[model samples]
Target: MSLATTKTSKIDRLAELTAKKETSSGASLWREAFRRLRGSKMAIIGAIVIAAFVVVAIVGPWLAPYAPTAQTWRGEVFANQGRFVGARGENLFGLDHLGRDMFSRMLVGARQTLLVGVVSMLIGLVLGALVGVVSGAAATLGGRAGQRLDDVVMRVTDIMLALPSLLLAVSVAAVLGQSLTTVMIAVGVVQIPIFARLLRGSMLAQGGKDYVLAARSLGIRKRRIVLTQIMPNSLSPVIVQATLSLATAIIEAAALSYLGLGNPDPAVPEWGVMLSQAQRFFDNAPMMSMYPAVAIIVTALGFTLLGEAMREALDPKLRG
Candidate 1:
């Protein structure tokens, strides 16, 4: 065979192999994400713990051995007969001052904690994404106007970032008054800057991609292109950000609760309020502190692990 023909055949084979390799790599990416996630021992453990807590929260009432509100007071001092309640065995978590079951309260508290985290992130995402998309798109109102808006938004974000988050939540919760809804709003409002910053950066980065430029060249509506094309492309980063934000939101809610700005009813078994109330009794009833503290730490750790896994999976640079 001619040398030129041989060379052409080699080039064709190389191109074919390259195409197959790329296809195989792309297919393996999803599988690799699951493998990496499962391989992270801490993340897997965290996921199990979080899942267990969620299940407890969901079925707590049914599993509770006694009504959470039932009080068993005895006539004699230090000899209370119907006083002890719930899962027996010397009261593993013990009873609160009001005689409510600690375990039950913790189970119920899960709903509150999860609610605040999810609701806050949702509100923050919507508001932040709107602000970011408009400001980051260079076509809208010329580059100077966009830059000015970005500057103003970023400065506001900086001011918010400067303030201590826990203190901010406490003050807001105090002003708003303690309630589940109020807690959600306080946490959500505080997180707006985070989402805005994330979205702005993502949008700006995505806007410069070839597909985005092609859309622009094709005279696609800026709004449609941004919403339909750019937004979808940026979701991987945003999803990871959201997962991490969930952990932050949970901690913030706990902080607010610790300051007595959480659930109005003291009977509710929330970890933060439990910690606040139990700190004084730490020397006497350490169980109170142990359970709730562990819950918060474990839950937060779970979300953090999930976030890390997601980041590694989606980011080609980080993936091995």
Candidate 2:
């Protein structure tokens, strides 16, 4: 055979092999992560629990037997000079100080709590991601000017970190006035530093990887490289943080509400508001406090477990 023909045949064979290899390895990172998540028993259980909570939040008002704030003392036997009352059959969880059905209040409260949690977390996630991306990109791509910007952002983050999260939230809530919006803003503000720092660190690490270096050498635009390449690669940690911070945000919202810093109206059926009201009846009726507290705990646990499982699934080091 002629030398030119032999060379052409070899090149064609190599191209065929490369195509087969590329096709075989076509699964994206997200697809693999999802596959890993499906195999995680903890992730599945946590997902189930979270789904249940979401369903309850959506349909709870309709399922409730009575208006959350409606006063009804239909079937209660007074004891201890009318200080304590027997559980009414109509109100499975009994009644509060004003005779509102505890079960109804709890059901409605789920919607309020989840709304605050989800909304606040979204605010935090968006603001934090913006700050983190700017800071990370500046530090990675900017020269001395970028360094100064990064320093300023990190210093501000450090200041926020120095303050206790709940205290910061309470202060913000107090300043904003007592309302659901105030509670959401307070919790979201407190969470900003956490997400900012996490994403910044992830982006910084990703910036130093081989792919990023190659992109830079190939004359890709800095913005394109950062947004399309680095940002996507660094988002696993942020996603995990978002899941975990959701639990924290819920607890913080409740705490702010408990402190009389959330939802000024006493008639609103919020978990935190319910707890605050239940405090006066702690001695006479403990069930009022028990119900809301359990809801908070279970909801937080579900998010936390799910976040941990996501971390394990996304992180190759943790994968067995």
Scored by lDDT, the top model is: 2
RMSD of 1: 11.6
Clashes of each: 1, 0
Model 1 per-residue lDDT tens digits across residues 128-198: 66765665564332377767877887777666655666766777778889787778778877777666666
TM-score of each: 0.82, 0.87
Query: For model 2, what is the alpha-carbon lDDT of residue 292?
Result: 95
User: Could you tell me which residue pairs clash in candidate 2?
Assistant: none
Candidate 1 Cα outliers beyond 4 Å, as residue runs:
1-24, 27-32, 73-90, 138-142
Worst 10 residues of 2 by lDDT: 14-23
Candidate 2 backbone overlaps, count = 0
Q: Residues 171-278, candidate 2, lDDT per residue (tens digit)?
A: 898898988999999999988877777777777777877888999999999999999988876776777778988999999999999999989899989998889888
lDDT of each: 0.67, 0.80
lDDT of 1 at 134: 65
